[model samples]
Target: MSLFTRLATSYFFYFAILGLISPYLSVFLDGKGFTSVELGEIFAILTATKIVAPSLWAILADKTGQKLLIIRLGALLALLSFIVLFWLNSYWPISFCLALFSLFWTAILPQLEVFTLTSVRHSSKIYARIRLWGSLGFIVLAVVAGQVMEYYAPGNLLNSEANLFTNAFVWMGTVILLCLLISTMVIKPQRIVNKPQQQALAITGKLLDLRFIIFFMAGVLLQISFGPYYGFFALFLRDLAYPGVAVGLLISLGVVAEILIFIFASSFFKAFTLKAILIVSLAATALRWFIVALYAESIWLLALTQLIHAASFALFHSASMIFISEHFTRCQQSRGQAVYLGGVYGVGGAIGAYIAGVLWLDGLGASTTFLTASVSAFIAALLMLFWPKTIKKPSQ
Candidate 1:
């Protein structure tokens, strides 16, 4: 396959599986008789592995100059580990399977980011164009899963919960297998030129810059605020009387906006400072969550809220990618991406998922959980207001 095709397809399948899990997995777990607290613990297990796995794999990939090899190995092992989910029907066993699966899965994306940026010579716009395919794949599977669940797992159907979730699990696994197949087809990544290693102190000193710390801390807050949505949005909709297909469409609406944002992300970057874009996205995220908290049962309000995902995720992510690309050196690129993943998606995700579980129980409820998320996003925006208007690019 051509380099462009390989890069785009990698994003497509990687997130296709993510689409299966992120929006539907809670419902699947609920169907299997797990409580909200158990779901939170299980999801935390899945995300917490991300904290260490990416960095460990990145160190090996950087030292060996074999990023594609690492990607391939991660994909293969992740697929193998995930296969155990089919046989493990209980809490600890399934959690163990998910933890193993996540360990391998976390190894793929950071290295892939370095490879894609290197392939395209670090044009952030081109990376967005390629990455948008992942959004497209996500939309497709989310809608399909919704429709399948509606047909087989409708509230009125006999044993619909089991039927609905079983099929969803099957499809989620199928997407992972597709990811593995595509991993085999992608063009191999070129080796990065390794540089003399920096001392631990020097590397630590560089990352300790005030701007860098504030930027990533804000990102952590943003992810933390997404806890309820990521962990329970589908279930929230279902409880509000929406069918499975409608729930899928609701989820897809956000990605649809995300896709549009990515198509024009390069233009936005060229036109605005990263800080400005980040502020707008963060502020909008706060608004989005507030609206969801207040009006989740209102289709119109939810649809309007979903459109803000373009700002919340797509624009915010584009700005952060540019920040990482400019701030870190080529040799440190994989690890920098690893830090972003580990910090924002890893640690942040774990905190959010677990907390959302706690807040999702009786008395507090989903709306209150989302209200807390909105407060968190607003705090993140307040932090972003202090970001430096300009950053000095580090020399590798």
Candidate 2:
């Protein structure tokens, strides 16, 4: 494969599995008789492993100068760990399986980011173009998986062949196998590895910079607010009487919006400062969650909210990726991505998943949870008003 195809393939299947789990995991768990709190706890367990795993794997990759090897290992192990979920019927076993899956899964993305940016020499247009294929992957699976689940949903667990094909765990494991197959073919970028021994103080200084600190905090808040949506959005839709296919379409609508933003992301980066893009995205996140809280039962209103995902996720992520690339020097790239991913996504996701669980109250507190999400995102936007001047627009 060409470099673009290789990176695109890596991202595509990585998030294809993500597309499966993110919108539908709770629905799958609910089908098995888990409570809202338990759902939250399971999601929390899944995210909590991300907290330390990425950083550790990054250290090894940096020290050994073997990032692609680590990516392959993580993919293979993650697939193996996830397959165990098929046999486990109870809560703890399921949680443990998810935790193991996540631990290895965390190792793939941070390292992949370092590899891609180095290979492309940090071109925003190319990176966004490649990354959007992942969104395409996500949209494809989100719709197909939803349709499959709707058509062949589990009943009489062991008796029916239809349920066997429709089962969430089965779908997730199959996607991971695809990822593992693709991992073998991608060309490893030439020598993007960090020599951490000499750069510890430099990395520490970058991490301690007030701009990166505030930036990281803003990201954490955004992810924390995502807890309700990520943990329970499909289940929430189910409560409002939307069928499986409609639920899939609604989720795909958000990714469709995300893809459009990515396609035009370079123009936005050139025209505006990173701070402006981030603040707008955060504000949109606030608006999106509020609309969901107030009008989830209204299909048109819900579709409007999904459209806002362009600003909320795609724009914000494009800006943040540029920020990280510029903020850290090349030597700091590996750990820098690890720290950002671990602290922002890892820790933030855990808190959000757990809190969403607590707030759900078996779906009775759904509005309250979304309202809380809006407030959190609004606050995150407020923090970016003071982003350092050094954080300027990207070059391309």
Candidate 3:
């Protein structure tokens, strides 16, 4: 198979598991008798581990020119760590297992991204088309898992049978392990052609460029703002008395928009500058959060708001990938992606999730939490306005 085909397949399986795990993991933890505070702590731990794991793994891949090796190792480790969940039950043990799994889990995606970018040189627009496969996988698995959970919820009474929750957790872990296995087999190893020999400090110096730093800061804040949305969107729906099908549809609506963007992103990029897209995406995020904050109770309004995810996430992500491809040297690419993930999704998300958790328990409700997210996105837009113009243009 072609490189893009392979990469797309790999991403499909990887994100399919993520689709199942991400949206429902909090629900599962809640089922396990975890308080809001405890669930937040667990999510924080998972994100916090990304702060270190990706960068460290990227450094090793850079030095050895063994990108595929690192990915294989990460996938294997993730599979093993997830299996350990079947045997552990209590909070500390569960947290320990999650953190361990995340250590390896965090390493896989950034490295895969570096590989994809390298393989698809000069046709980066195609990246989104490939990435849309992941989104498709996410939508499918999330809907199926939502149905499964709903089916089981009626049969089991809460606060009575801990084993049912444990069974669900094990099932999630098993699905993840199977996906990792498939991803491992399908992703062919690529030789790293532009391996870095300089000390890590030299590469770190590149990030000091004011433009890159500003963009990174904006990206971090964007993700941080998403903390509450990701952590509590379903729970919020449940709180609003929405049924399982409605919750699944709400989640699927966002991804459907994302998929549409991915399908046409190459064309969109051809017509717009990366900075223009970035600004628009940030603005959409700001608006989306406000809608969620004020009008989430209206399903029609909420569904319309979900369409903005095309701009908020898909566009922003595509722009960032293009920016990295244009601005950074090939040798620096993996580390650049790793730093982006670690700083933005890792550090920023941890802070946002923790703060959101606090607000959630404090009775601030989803409206207030979402309003805070909107404020964060508005600030990110202001920051993006001053980003270096050089990074916005496609490479000559």
Candidate 1 per-residue lDDT over residues 191-263, each given as its tens digit: 5455546312124554787778999889999999998888888888888889889999989999999999999
lDDT of 3 by residue, 24-54 (tens): 8877777677888887888888889989888
User: Of models 2 and 3, which has the larger lDDT?
Assistant: 2
Write the number of the candidate with greater lDDT, choosing between 1 and 3. Answer: 1
After superposition, candidate 3 runs with Cα above 4 Å error: 154-166, 195-201, 362-364
Displacement of residue 297 (Cα, Å) in model 1 is 1.3
- The lDDT for every candidate, in the order shown, is 0.83, 0.86, 0.80
Compare the candidates by lDDT and give the number of the best one: 2
**Residue 322, model 3: Cα distance from true site in angstroms:** 0.9
Q: Which candidate is the best by TM-score?
A: 2
Please provide, for model 2 over 256-346, each residue's C-alpha lDDT reduced to its tens digit, 9 standing for 90 to 100.
Answer: 9999998998999888888888999999999999999999989999999999999999999988889999998777777888899999888
Q: Rank by TM-score, descending?
A: 2, 1, 3
Better of 1 and 2 by TM-score: 2
lDDT of 2: 0.86
Q: Could you give the C-alpha RMSD of every candidate to the true structure, in order shown?
A: 2.5, 2.1, 2.1
